[model samples]
Target: MHQQLPPEQLDRLICLEARIHKKSKEEIIQEQFLQIESEKQTDENDRNKQNMDSNKKSDDLKCSQNSENSPQKLFTSQNLSPVQKKSIITKKHSQQKKKKKTKEGQQKDITQYLQYQKKQQKAKKCEQKLMEYSIQDSPFKNKSPLPSDPALEKQLKEKQNQIAISEIKIKELETHNSELRETISSLTEQQLRIQDVVKQFAIENEKLKKQQLQVQLQTNRVRLGEYVVQREKTALVDVWIDGQELREAKEQSKRLEVLKAEYENKKKNSKNKEEQEMRTLNVKLNFLIKEEQQLQETVDRLETEKNLHIKQLKRVYEEEHARFTKNNDYPLIGERYQVLSLLGKGGFSEVYKAYDLQELREVACKIHQLNSNWSDHAKQNYIRHAIRENRVHKELNHPHIVKLYDSVEIDKSSFCTVLELCDGPDLAYYIKKYKCFPEKEAKLLVGQIISAIKYLNNHKNKIIHYDLKPQNILFHLNELKISDFGLCKVLEDDNSKLQLTSQGVGTYWYLPPECFHMGDQPPNISSKVDIWSIGVIFFEMLFGQKPFGQGVSQEKILKEQIIVKSQSVTFPQKPIISNECKEFIRGCLAYNQVDRLDVHQASNHPYFQKKLN
Candidate 1:
C-alpha cells in the first residue's frame, strides 16, 4: 500500500508533514488532496458530458469485437494500447452496453436468415429442374421464338435485312477476334515472366493477415470505451463529493475555532468591563460613606442638613436594582440569547433564554447555580452536581453528550453549568406533537440513543444515570441524548462498584421494578438500572405510554397493574409494526432485570431491523 501511492501524492504528504511541524493544522490532506483535485477535474468533465447525454452527443465509439479470429479496428489516434480503457467518468452512468444478441434472439435471427437464403436457393433449384424437364419433354422448346404476329410479310423483309446485317457483323467480329488472339498470345508470354512478382505479392498479403490476427489476439475483447468512460466519471463524482465534503468540513472547523477564540475574548472583555464599573461604583460609595462619617461626627450640629440627600440616594438604588432584575431573563447570558425566548421550567432548575456564548453561535444554556430559594440540602446537592457535571462533560467526547463551554463556581454555594442548547424538542413533547414516528426512523433514533448509552457503559468510571426518562432525554436533530446529569453518579474508577437506592429519585414512571421494591433489599444494581430506564423510554417511544398507567387511583396505578402484569401495554391497531420491532419492545419491558436486554446485545437486536445503521 505504501509503495502504491503515485509520486505526486507522496510529495503532498511530505509538504503536509512539514506544515504540521510548523503548527498549522489546516492544510490539504496529504494522502488524498492530489488525488481528489486530479479526480475533481476529470469528474467535472464527465459531468459536462453526462449533461449533454440528453442531446445524444456522447462519444459514438463503442465496443466492436467478438471472435478471436476476427480482428477489428483499434483507434491508434489515442494510442490506448493498454488492455483496460480509461475515461473522465464518475457515478454509475456508464455507457449502456449495446444489447447484444441474447442466446434466444441470436438463434431466432440465424434461423430466419437461413430460411430466407434457403427459399432463394430452392427457387433456383426449381428453375433448373424445370429447364431440365422441358429439354427432356420437347427438343424444339429451346430452338427459337414463334413467329406469332401479323408480321408474316414483314418477317420475310426482316429476314433479308437481318441476313445482310449478320453477314457484315460476322465479318467484323472475325477480324477483331483474330487480332485479339495474337495479343493474348503475346500477353501469355509476358505473364510467364511475372510469375515471381505475383508470388511475392501473395506473400505480403499473407503477412498482413497474420498481423491482423495478432492484433486481434491482443485487443479483440470488446472494448466499451464510452461505457467505461461513464463509469470512471461516476466513480470520480463519488470521490469529488467526498472531497468537497472534506474541504467544507475543514473550513467549518477553522471557522469554529476562530469563533470560539472570538467568543472567549468577548467574554473576557465583558467581565473586565463589568469589574471596572463595579470598582468605580465601589469607590464612589466609599467616598460617600467617608463623607457621611465625617458629617455624622458633626451631625448634632447639622443633623437636618444631610437628611434630604440620603433619602434621594436610597430611592435611586432601589429603582436601579428592580430595573436590572426585571430585564435580565437569563442566568447564562454573556452577549448572546436576546431572542428564541424561554422554553420551559424546572423545580430547582429554570430553563432560560441564555445563549451558548461559545464559539460564534448561541444555543440554550441550562444554568444550574445556587440561589436564595434553594435550601441547604439543595445547595449541597447543586454543588456536588455542578462539580460532577463539569467533570463528566469535560472528560466525554461524543456527539450525544451536550458540550460544556466553561464551568464557574460563583461565591460559596453558587455554580453555573454552561451547555449547548439543542434544536429539537424533548421526546415526550415530540410524541405529543407527532403521535408516532415513521417505523424505520423511530428505530434509527432508538439505535443511536442506545449506542450512546452503550458508549457510556463501557467508558471508564461508568456513568450511573440515577435519572433516566423521556423528559431528561432531548431529541437533538438525529441523536436521542441522555441529558441533565444532576442526579447522575460516576462510579469509582478502579472500584466501579455502584450503590443503587430504593429511595426512588429519577422519573417514577421509567424506574425499574427492582428499584421500586427495594424496601428491605440490600444495595441496588449497577448502571444496569439506567438500562431499564432506557428500556422504559424505548417502550414509550414505540407504544406511546408508560408500562403501567390505567387507574385513576395512585396506588391502583402503581401496584395493582405494571409489576405483576406487564402485558397491559398495547399499541394502536391500525399502525404497522414489524414482528421484529415488537419483540424488542417486549424484551425491554421485562419486569425482571435478569430477563432484560443488556446494552451490548440490545443495540444489534434484530428488532432494530438492521435499520439503525
Candidate 2:
C-alpha cells in the first residue's frame, strides 16, 4: 500500500510521474486512439445499462466495490459517451486552430492547464491512498487483501525519487526567476538616474548660455559708455574753442571802443582848451577861498577845544594828585575775591591782583565801572561786551588762552570778572623791555598764538579774536597766552560772512584795512583779518617797530593810504633775518584780505617750520 501524502506534495509527485511516464510521439498518438475507443466502449455500456435498468443498480454497486478494490478505477473523460467525446474533440480542434494564430499565448495557457490538471490528479490520488489506508485498518479486514506485487513497490520508490528531483529543479527555477526580477529592477533604477543626469546637464547648459548673453550685453554697454564720453569730450573742446574766439572778439571790440572815445576826447579838448582853462582857474580860485574859510573855522574850533581840554586835565591832575597824597582808594569787590593789589587800570575798568577765598587761588579781578553820566545805551553796550568776553573766556579751554574763573555783579552798575593771573608781563611790556625777539623765539610764540586762535576758530561755538595785539597777549612761566576777548566776535553757525560792530575797539596800528571802514558800513571781516594783524605783530617782533612807521599819524593809518605806501618800502637789511621770514611777512601783510595768508597757511610757513627743528 502507498503512503498518504499532502495535496501540495502529491501534486509535485504527479508532475514527476507524468514526466517519467512520458512516451514517444508514436506512443502518444496510439494513446489518443485508445482514449477514443474507450469512450465508444463506455457509450455502449451506458446503452446496455439502460436496457437492463432492473440490473443497473446491482451493477453500480459492483462497480463501486471494484473502484474501492482498485483505486485506479476512477471516473475520467474516458468514461464519457461517444457523442460527448465527439463534441469535446470537435471543440478542442476548433480551439487549437483558433489558438494557432497566437502560439505563444496558447502555449502558456496549455502549460497552466496541464499544471492544474496534474494538481487535480494528485489530489485524487491522495484521496485514494487515504481510502486504501482506511480499508486496511477497517474491522472488515478479510473483505480484501492488499496487493503484494514487488513490481508495484519498486514503481512507488522510483516515483518518490522522481518527485524529489522535480522539487529541487522547481526551487532552482524559482531562485533564477527572483534573481532575474531583481536584475531588471536594478537596471530600471539606473536608467532613471541617467535620465535625471541628462536633464541636469541641459539645465546647466541653458544657464551658461544666459550668462554668456549677459556678459555680451555688459561689454556692449561699456563700449557705448566710452563712446558717449569721447563724444562729450569732443563737444566740450569745441565749446571751449568757441569761448576763446568770442573772448578775443570782445577784447578787440573793447579796444576799438576805447580808441574811438580817446579820439573824440582829443577833438573836444582841442576845441575847448582856452574856455576850459579859464573855467578851471575860476573854479580853483573859488574852492581855495572856501577851503581857507573852512580851515580858519576848524583852527578856531580846535583852539577852543584845546583850552577846554587843558583846563579839565588840570582839574583831574589836581584831584588825582591830592588823592595820591592821601591814599589809594580801591573799591571793595565781592567777598568771594579779596583784592590784594591793583594790577592795572583802563578807561572803564580796573584790574587787581586778588585771592579767591572759595578756591584759595590767586586770580586777577577786572572791575567794570558804569558811570552815571553814560547813556543807557552806552551802559548796556558796555555791559554786553563784558558779558560776551566772560562767556568766551569761560567756553575756551585751550592751554594758551586765559581762563575766566568767575563773574559777579558787585552792585547795580559795577561787575567784576575773576581771571587767571599771570606772573610775567604782557607781550607789549616784554617787547618794550627786550626791544626785539629772536626769530626762533618769535616763531614759537607765534605758533602758540596760532594754535589758540585755531582752537577758538574751530570750536563748536566759533569765535574770532578780532582785536589780537601784543597788549592782549600775556606771558606766564615763559609761556604765551592770548587774553582779553573783549572785542572777540562769536560767529553764527549758518552765516560765513562776519560784520564788524560799529565801534572799532581794536588798536588802530594793528587794525586790518577793512576795520578802518567801520564808520561808513560795518565791513565783512573774516579770520584773514586776524592773520593780517598777526603779520604786523610778527613784523614788530622782528624790527622792534611797526611795519608802518610808528610816527605815521593815526589819521593816515585810518585812511589806509599808509598801508599802500608801506607795502612798497623794502624791509631793513638785517643780517639776522632771513629772506624767508620777509616773504612770510609779505604774504600775511597782503593788502587784499583775499590775497593774505590765512591762519592755517601762516602756521605752516617755512619760518615756523624751522622752529620745529
Candidate 3:
C-alpha cells in the first residue's frame, strides 16, 4: 500500500527520481557515443582491409601476367640462356612468396579487424540494452512497451506496482484523515454539551444553596420569636414584683402619717410650761422624723414606678425600633419628648427639633450617642465633657449665650440636652449665604459674640470657650449667641492661665498660633486664644474668606502657623475695611498672647463703637 506523505516530502521524492533518471539518460547517451565511435573505427578498418586485399589481388594478377608473358617470350626466343630461365623462375618464386607473405599479413589484419568489429557490435548491443534498461527503470517515464531486458522489465513492473500501491496508501490515508477530522469535531461538540451540563449543574447548586440559607433564616426567626416570648414573661414578673414593692411602700407611708398625727395631738395637751415646751420640742422632732420616713417611702415607691415605666418604655422602643429600621428613621426618645425633625448633626451629637412635654415648648435636643466602638476611657472622657457642657451652659445667664433648659439621660448609651432653639441660622449659614457680611452687620455680630465671650471670661470661675468658631455661633433674631461649650475650660480665678491637655481640640482654621505645639503636652494658653478665633471669624465675615485663605490642608496650616507665628495673616483691600476695623482685627490676632486683645477689649473696640443704621 502507498504510505501517505506530506506534500513537501512527496515533491522531494519526485525531484530525486527525476534527477536520477536524467543522470542515467546522460550516462546512456555517453555510452551510445562510445559505441558509435567504435562502429566507425571498425568500418574504417574493414574498408582499409578491402582496399589492401584488392591491391594485393591486382599485384598478384600482374605478377601472373608477367610470368605468362615471360614464358611466351622465352618460347619465341630459342637463343635465350638456361641461366636466364632459371633466374626468371627464381624471380617468379620470390615474387610469389612475397605476395603470399603480403596476402597472409593482410588476411591476418582482416581477421583481427573482423573479430574486433564483432566485439564492438556486441559491446554496442550491450550498451543499447543497458540504455533500454535505464529508460525502463526510470520511475518518471511514461507508460510504453517493455524493453528487451527481462530483469529490467521485471524491475520496472515491480516499481510500477509500488507506485500504484503508494497511490492507494495515499488515498487510504486521506480517507483516514477525513475520519479523524470528523472524530475531532464530534469530540468538540461533546465537550460543549458537557460544559452546558456543568453550567446547569452550577445553577442548580446555587438554588440549593439559597434554599439552605432561607431555611437557616427561618430557623433564626423561630429562635428570635422564642426569645421575645421569654422576655415578655420576664417583664411581666418584674411588673408583679414592682407592684408588691409599691403596696408595701404605700402601707409604710400610711403608718408614718398616723404616727405624725398622734405626736401633734400630744404636743397640744402638755401642762407645765418647761415640760410643755420640752414635750412640744420632742413632738416636733418626732413629727419631723415621721415626715422624713414618709418621704423616704414615697421616694422608694416613685423610684420603683419609674423603673417599671422605663422597662415598659424600653419594650415599646424596641418594637418601634424594629419598625423604624425598615424606614431608616430615628428611634423614639422617652415619653417626655417627641422628635419633630432633625436640626443638625455633628461628629458626636445629633440635634433634633423636639417638643418637650413637661415644659410644653419646642427645644433643640442635642443627643450624644455613646458609640460602642470607643474605648472605655474615651467614652468616659466624652461623658465627662458632656456633663461639663451642661454645667457650663447652666451657669451662664448671658443673653447672647445659648440656654440649657434640661439634660436627660435617655439611656445608658445616649443622653439628650434640651437647649433654646435659635430663631435664625448659625453665623456659618449667613457667611455662606452672603459670602461676606456688611461691615456694620459684621461689627454688630462680632460685638455680640464678644459680649458672650467676655461674660464667660469674667465669671467667678473664669471660663475659656476654646472651641469658638462661626459654626458654634448661633443667631437668634439676628442676635449672635455663643453655643457648644463642650470644650469650655473653667479656670479657678481670672489670674489663672488655661492649661490645655489635648492639642487640635477645636477647628484648625480658628485655632490660635500658640495652640500648635511641638511636644506631646499641649501648650498652656490663655483666654486670648478665643480672641484670636474671633479675629479669624471677623476676618472671614469681612473678606468672604479666612485670613489665611482656604483649600490648603490642616497640616500645611499648622506648619505655616509654626513658621510664621500668626504673622502671615493678610488683610485684603477689596472690601475697603476701615483702618480702625483692620487694626482691631490685628490686635485680636496678635502673635503674642499678651499683645492679643481680650474679649472685653475686643467688644469695646472702635470697630464695634461705630453707629449702624
> What digit string (tens of lDDT, one per residue) describes model 2 on residues 1-613?
0133444554465456557677432344345446545655775686587669848867886877766765445454237888998998799768756544444443343345456667877999778667766786666543564589899878977997799899999999999999999999998788657644544454455457546745753443332211122246447331111123233444555555555565455545655568776566556556555655665454444434333333333333443443111264333356456564455666677676766645656788887878899999999999898887887789878889888888888778778888999988788866665658888788788888888878877788767788788988899989988888878887877554588775446677777677666356678888887788888898888878887748777776766656545543257666278778888888888877778887778877777777433
Residue-by-residue lDDT tens digits, candidate 1, 1-613? 1233334554455467768676321233333345544655776687788688844532433423332223344444345644434443322334322111232343343344445547877999778667866677577545554666668757876897799899999999999999899999988767644543443443455457546744642231221101112256447431111223233444555555555565455555656567766566556556555554554444322222222223323333343343222464222233323222344546455443343222434455554547777788978876776677778877776787766666645345444455667777677766644445777777777777777777777788877666777777786776777677777777776544455653545556666666555455556566666767766676666655555552234455465545545543465664667778777776776667677777777877776646533
In candidate 1, residue 11 scores what lDDT? 43
What local lDDT score does residue 156 receive in model 3, on the 0 to 100 scale? 84
TM-score of each: 0.43, 0.46, 0.46
Cα RMSD (Å) between model 3 and the true structure? 32.2
- The lDDT values for all models are 0.56, 0.67, 0.71
Residue range 1-613, candidate 3, lDDT tens digits: 0133444453354456558676442244344346555655775687699789979978876786777767665555556688998998799769757755654554444444445557877999778667766885675344464559989977987998799899999999999999999999999789667654554454455457546755753443332211132256447332222334455566677776677667666666655447767666696767679677767857554554444344434443443443222363433456565564456667788777666544556678888888889999999999998888888788789899999887778777888888999978778766765667888888877888888888888898888898988889998876888889888888884665867787766788888778777676667887888899888999999988987637667787766764245475678768887788889988988887888887778877776777755
Q: Which is the winner by lDDT between candidate 1 and candidate 2?
A: 2
Error of 2 at 541 (Å): 1.0
